[model samples]
Target: MANLQLAVKGEYFDAMIRGEKTEEYRLCNDYWNKRLVNRKYDCLIITKGYPKRDDFSRRIDVPYNGYEIKTITHPHFGDKPVKVFAIKVKLTRSNYVAR
Candidate 1:
């Protein structure tokens, strides 16, 4: 049997309210062989900010108007050496709430 392992790390960035760019960070890995095999690559965390309703149909860009970001780490990957998954949150002007 082959030995394999996987892991994931996540980090949340502070809100940027005047630039117009939301940034996030994370670490992940892809496991090929192990007690369990995992073959997926996706962001374990997603973040968004809630802006007040305005005359504009769309919401201002997050970075442009300062927005908050929250990151979460999933348990798909345990603790092994794999790959790094850097996450970035881009919020466009919109009234839509995060689902």
Candidate 2:
């Protein structure tokens, strides 16, 4: 099993920049496992500073073979520091799969 690392940087700032409320959640990188082989995968957002699990499925949605998705607050150079977070998921297809 391979791990697909996904990250969301400046998530807090993006909410402020777009004039939207900050998502009171964080990626659940701990409970994530790459052993699951199901087509339908789930990513549980493990909220920091809180003892609860919240699923921000609407905000952080990606398909099985999705490219790396990064979130930043600003577009130009020399802006706010970009905070990077990473998550690992499993890949469905294998190159050595029999044709």
Candidate 3:
């Protein structure tokens, strides 16, 4: 099991917390693809922010909630064989403030 802190948008965060969004998609990157693959269990912390392409410094530290990774999938990106992390998670807690 791995403890991973991920930043998500406010809307998506709300959806996940409300049990509307079950799966989360991550872009195909070498680091993420390697780290996420074959990981059976994950303690995912949902932060109240999203990654910006231009400014990487703009981020929130407080976690909105935590979830347990139920399943993982490697989905194709377009026509190319790309590794994407399709994480199916179950909400553990809400209003969780990360320290």
Candidate 4:
């Protein structure tokens, strides 16, 4: 019944609401590992750009499934393949706010 909060750009936020993005990627360095590894979260709370805490319109709440470590070559990470923790999530809940 816990939650993990994250701040992302508008495009990724929109993509999630559109059912195109299901997993949130985090770098596999010590920073992320300390927070995501062996952590159990019930919800994933994401913000469009670190808006005010009460600004639900710019935020997304999704069910957190879990996470797995993976290696991928995504531009967000850089021009080379990198290791990351792919945090699983879903936007199929009735309470999802698509704004």
Q: Could you estimate the TM-score for every candidate?
A: 0.25, 0.20, 0.52, 0.89
In terms of lDDT, the best-performing candidate is 4
Model 3 lDDT per residue over 1-99, tens place: 556667777777778766687666676567776656555433555555855544433322222233233334443335545445665555444533222
| TM-score of candidate 4 versus the correct structure, residues matched by position | 0.89
lDDT, candidates in the order shown: 0.31, 0.32, 0.53, 0.85
Clashing pairs in 1: 16-66, 17-66, 20-63, 20-64, 21-63, 59-93, 59-94, 60-93
Q: Write the residue-wise lDDT of candidate 2 on 3-29 in tens digits.
A: 332334455424423445323222223
Worst lDDT 10-window in candidate 2: 90-99
The local distance difference test score of model 3 is: 0.53
Cα displacement (angstroms), candidate 2, residue 67, comes to 4.5
Distance (Å) between predicted and true CA of 81, model 4?
A: 0.6
Model number with the top TM-score: 4
Question: Candidate 3, residue 52: CA error in Å?
Answer: 18
Which ten contiguous residues of candidate 4 have the minimum total lDDT? 90-99
73 Cα displacement, candidate 4 (Å) = 0.4
Better of 2 and 4 by TM-score: 4
Could you give the C-alpha RMSD of every candidate to the true structure, in order shown? 13.4, 12.8, 7.4, 1.5
Q: After superposition, how far is residue 24 of candidate 2 from its true place, in Å?
A: 22
Worst 10 residues of 1 by lDDT: 3-12
